[model samples]
Target: MPRTRIHNMNISLDGYAAGEHVTFDAPIGGAERLFDWFDGRVIHGVDRVDAPVTLDRAVISLWSQGIGVEIMGRRKFGPQTGEWPDDGWRGWWGDEPPFHTPVFVMSHYPHPSIDFPNGTSFHFVDAPPHEVLRLAQEAADGRDVRIGGGPSTVRQFLQADLIDFMHLVIVPITLGRGVSLWEGLAGIEDRFTVETVTSPSGLTHQFWNKNGHD
Candidate 1:
């Protein structure tokens, strides 16, 4: 069976995954400081110019590995809500999205499926996590399905016990307020074999694997 996975999810030292207010102006809230560990050039898709390969770059690069389909909440798809304001708003990524495979956006209000030129497509659906996971798994065609998140979505899947693997990056900053990833997930660590690794950039990487899986 193909596994469901989450990778490179960054959280603040205080456990907030995003900031209090999220708008087009502040897509990730004020938690941009949490990503300072990554080399700016690598994240922005700039070609490397002799920069040493650091832990941050290595970890960020692992995002697309073994992922054939992605599922995300509507918030992660965009900053819009309640009957999308415009159809022209594709997503935060312009022209070409990073995910080349199908991405299912979880929304209460469904819209026509969107197909982009760069092999990235968006399908809007109102199904619950399990149903959406089934659809994503089918689209994945045996490859792993990635739960690309904005805190709330990941929390829902974690609550449903559907995630098979996860890589969480704990940044050394505190947002104080925002959606938290561990809000109601008490004792979630008991279900997985957790391992912690600290990078030279001061970020701590937490790996969680389902108890029975390798």
Candidate 2:
């Protein structure tokens, strides 16, 4: 069955998934170090010539596997707030977005959909989590829907019990003040079967499969 999944979400040791202020200059906010271990090449199936495929790279490579559509928060789309300006800003990613699928961006403001030649299209909507998920699932056809996050988006899906699988990478750093992933999700592990794996790069990868889901 097609499932709702979250992948390659980097969180700090303090449970913060993103920093306090997200600006156009700093996309992930001040928590940039959380993704230091990430290699963008792996997402496109590129391998490093200097070294063999490591465990971390192997896991990160699964980010786009089986994903047909993505749902992300407005913050993940861009650094705009309260009525998008007429600046004609497409998105953080230029013409060719990494996601080669239909992406639904959650936002309160309405905007026309943007399409790219690489099959990446961004649709802006103001619906709740369940409604958005329904739209995404429909666009996904028979494939899985991925929840691309900025923490708040993922939290909403978790709160609605709409996520079937999650892959969280725990970096060993602590951001004392930032957007947390476990804010109101106390005892959320009870709903899933969690497994942990520590990579040689010191990143702990946690896989959460919703209970009763394969």
Best by TM-score: 2
lDDT of 1 by residue, 145-206 (tens): 99999889999999999999999999988777888999999999999999999998788999
- The global C-alpha lDDT for each of the candidates, from Candidate 1 onward, is 0.85, 0.90
Q: Every model's Cα RMSD, please? A: 2.3, 1.6
The residue-by-residue lDDT of candidate 2 on 1-214, one tens digit each, is: 9999999889998999998789989888888888776754427443532367777887887878888999999999988999988888898888889999999999999889999999999999899999999999999999999999999999999999999999999999988989999999999999999999999899999999999865
Minimal lDDT window, size 10, model 2: 41-50
Q: For candidate 2, list the clashing residue pairs, or say none.
A: none
Where in model 1 is the C-alpha error above 4 Å? 40-50
Model 2, backbone clash pairs (residues 3+ apart or across chains), number: 0
- Winning model by lDDT: 2
